[model samples]
Target: MDAAYVFAVRFRLDPDRGVAVEPETFETRLRRPADDPGESGWLFFRDNLWRGDLADAESFRGLTADALGVLVESVEYRALETDREYYDALREAIAADLAPFNADSVDEVVSKYLGSSVEIRR
Candidate 1:
């Protein structure tokens, strides 16, 4: 149940910055542990996502731009790829954590944040 939150980032660099810049697009992913559903600090999606997309594109773009030191043109969410085993555990964890989020159910929480972006891989 290996998992990651994938994104496609389009950015441009200024040649006048006095450095050779290559690649206009970058593919980045934040990996998640497959076995540790209750791991501390595992709220990546809950913190950064909303309604199947980024909670704040402008702020995310700013962060990405700052990280890369470039002008970010756009950011696209790809998917959260994982297996069934981990997904089930994630649901359980989400259920346990639902109180703080003021959510009714795990499915609601998942749908609110992930929507159709979750891909189950064998």
Candidate 2:
């Protein structure tokens, strides 16, 4: 089994302005450790959106409509693994929990937030 990391990003807009700019979001999944391979979905998406990772400032000025109106407020992510060791560990954890808070399996927990853009690692 392999590891898959799911990234869910939320970009909040400036509050001082009179208008309410709707929050923007992007979700992507990737493999293992969340680092390396600078071209990974995580880095490519992150850099391109938040940083001026493009060839020139002209690209940025042109893309954001002359004013870089949006700025990133926060980012959050989750990691999932389905290897034998992880599976066995989750099984033990589920088995020894209280009924009200108990989960049928790791898949059950992961599925709750996996949504359509992503798949449960299993």
Candidate 3:
């Protein structure tokens, strides 16, 4: 069966705990399997997802994951619509973007859909 491209964005709502969600948050740290290549994109995604109110925190649809000794408020995921003909164009765009950093073609799927959100961890 053909695989799907899915973006899983991890967010920690309690800023008081001091989790740096800023751009380059993954830099300076050792590269791990769960590290984000670009926090800038995640920040952009989170901003667009915000609804002007965080009161519905519990109502937000997401899975739960522990991060920094605290539960990340939401671990949301979205699959891309890859069956469309436009997917070919999207793949080319993503391949160009990730070519500078990776040698594998597998990243084409992840980066194409998560380009504006986050990257698949190494």
Candidate 4:
């Protein structure tokens, strides 16, 4: 099984750079293994999130702009969608990794990074 961190992005093409198109919107997903919560490269939440939201919207918009070659106007955090089995593993991993963080429990860590945006699907 796999999980995805999903987001909604709104962007526009720069007229100076190329033929300008109308502003557009789309949903994007960064996919990962459902069970591998401790994978080093799977630290997207830790790196990009703060208190359940993007740590820096301007930086995120810049990254999106570069990736899509457009002017990113806005970004909205959606949810971390995964299965119940994987969610359990992720909570366990968060508990193990809690030593270095300021939180005292896995729930705190999850709340800090993901908040109410976690969706556990069957």
Identify the leading candidate in terms of lDDT: 1
lDDT of 4 at 91: 82
lDDT of 3 by residue, 1-122 (tens): 12233334344434567565554222111111221223233222222233222223454323233323434434344433233333454346446565543436735444433444333222
Task: Write down the lDDT of every candidate, Cα atoms only.
Answer: 0.75, 0.37, 0.36, 0.74
Please, what are the lDDT tens digits per residue for candidate 4 over residues 1-122? 46777767877555665566554444454343433677765668777777767888889878877877877787766788987877888888777778766789988888888888999897
> How high is each candidate's TM-score?
0.78, 0.29, 0.26, 0.80
**Ranked by lDDT, top first:** 1, 4, 2, 3
Cα RMSD to the true fold for all candidates: 3.2, 14.4, 14.5, 2.9
Q: Rank the candidates by TM-score, best first.
A: 4, 1, 2, 3
For residue 112, give model 1's deviation from the true position in Å: 0.7
Per residue, candidate 1 scores C-alpha lDDT tens digits across 1-122 of: 56777777877756775677576455554344433577875677788888789888888888878877878877766678888887888888888768866689988888888878999987
Lowest lDDT 10-mer window, candidate 4?
26-35
- For residues 55-76, write the lDDT of model 2, one tens digit per residue: 2334433443323345533333
Give residue 9's lDDT in candidate 4 (0 to 100).
80
Tell me the deviation in Å of residue 115 in model 2. 6.6
Angstrom error at residue 60, model 1: 0.9
List ranges where model 4 is wrong by over 4 Å: 15-35
- Model 1 spans with C-alpha error above 4 angstroms: 17-35
RMSD of 1: 3.2
Question: Which model, 2 or 4, shows the larger TM-score?
Answer: 4
